[model samples]
Target: MRRSVLGLLALLASTALQAATSVRYCDYPVYPPVSWSDGKQPRGLAPTVVRELFGRLGYRVEMVVLGNWQRCLLDAAEGRVDVVLAYTSAQREQTLRFSKVPVLREEVAVFANRQHPLAFNRLEDLARYRGGLLFGESYGPAFDQFVAQHQNIEWVSSSGQNFGKLIRGRIDFVIQERRTGQLFVEHLPGAGDIVALPPALSVDYLRVAVSRRSPLSAHMAEIDAQLQQMADAGELERWLQESEVTYRDMVRQP
Candidate 1:
């Protein structure tokens, strides 16, 4: 009877070990290709990659589609979520534990009115122009230095709104992701007026971050290692491509 009871207890322990680890993840829902939900469900390249990587690591991932970029950062900062993916910037690194593997790179570029394009290979060239930047977003150390030293630049609330204001000639040029601005403009009424430039401010690497308050701090290195493995195998890009195709199909469906 004692041996039988021990065997049953061991079986229960094994079963418990097999159960998925629950992880809550948050992301900006408006940013497409990176993260955006269909209102009813979460679906995007960033979320897809997060889901796949964690799933393989034995975690049951749940995606939270937070309203705005700033709020999503806040949620992660407050430890209201276990992890936040596709995050970048040294400013953010000061507050959160970050992934060593960069999920992707975003080219920070300037968009201007087609008639008066802002031409420059370097950031210093734009010092003479009045630049419009999103209020809560950080472009990195160099851009931050430029913004601080240049009185010509002004910060605004929304990237979409900034693009609109730029179209109306309210601001000289707006800074944001090259692909993001393109995707956003494609869906906007004033898309015809905006033009993204050839020169990018920087290629910011996107990474998954864990909150300092999260219980998963011990596993961050493990997560980073797994992500690096995925990167080495080109699994991350392959997953992104697959998710892009899926997102396109989902959007195309009537």
Candidate 2:
């Protein structure tokens, strides 16, 4: 009787050890190609890479659209979620730990009406033209301050809306990420005349970040190593290309 009780307790402990650990992740629902939730799971480069990386590290990972971008950040900060794949900002650094290796690079570019392009040689040159920017978007501190002080730029609620306003000549230019702007121009009817100006306004990175309060924060170096291997193997670029096609298909679907 004593032996049977000991064996039963050992079996229960073994069963607990065999259980897989699960990780919850969140991302922006509308930022295509890099990461966007499909109203179900996250789809795009960063999400896919992070999922693969963490899964291989023996964690059961699921990326979901918990809410909007702001909500996702809040959740990651407050420990409601274990992981969030996004860009790093000084404000976010207080509560979130970021991987040393970025999952991808994002190029912020200027899109202008081809019929009335602005001769943009330097930052101050933008002051000569009227422009539109997405509401709540940030282009780093210096650029933001310049926009506030020197430029006559209007704000719109959505990136697509900014492009639409540009079409009607309401704004002379639109500031956007280069690839994302390409997708918008391709998908938005009457945006055919929109062209991304050369020499991107700025280059930023997309990284996989974990909440400081989460246990995964201990695996930061391992995550960075995996991301560097992915970069070396060309997996990240392949995923980016695939995401573009996937997103275009999603846009075309009725």
Query: Model 1 off-target regions past 4 Å?
Result: 1-20, 86-88, 151-158, 246-254
Q: Point to the candidate with the largest lDDT.
A: 2
Model 1 lDDT, full chain set: 0.75
lDDT of 2 by residue, 71-169 (tens): 778888999898987667777788899988888788989899987778986678898889887554666776878888975888765666788888888
Best by TM-score: 1
Model 1 is weakest, by summed lDDT over 10 consecutive residues, at 12-21
Candidates' lDDT values, in order?
A: 0.75, 0.79
Tens digit of lDDT per residue, candidate 1, span 149-194? 8877776656667887888887788887787677767656666978
TM-score of each: 0.80, 0.78
lDDT of 2: 0.79
Error of 2 at 99 (Å): 1.2
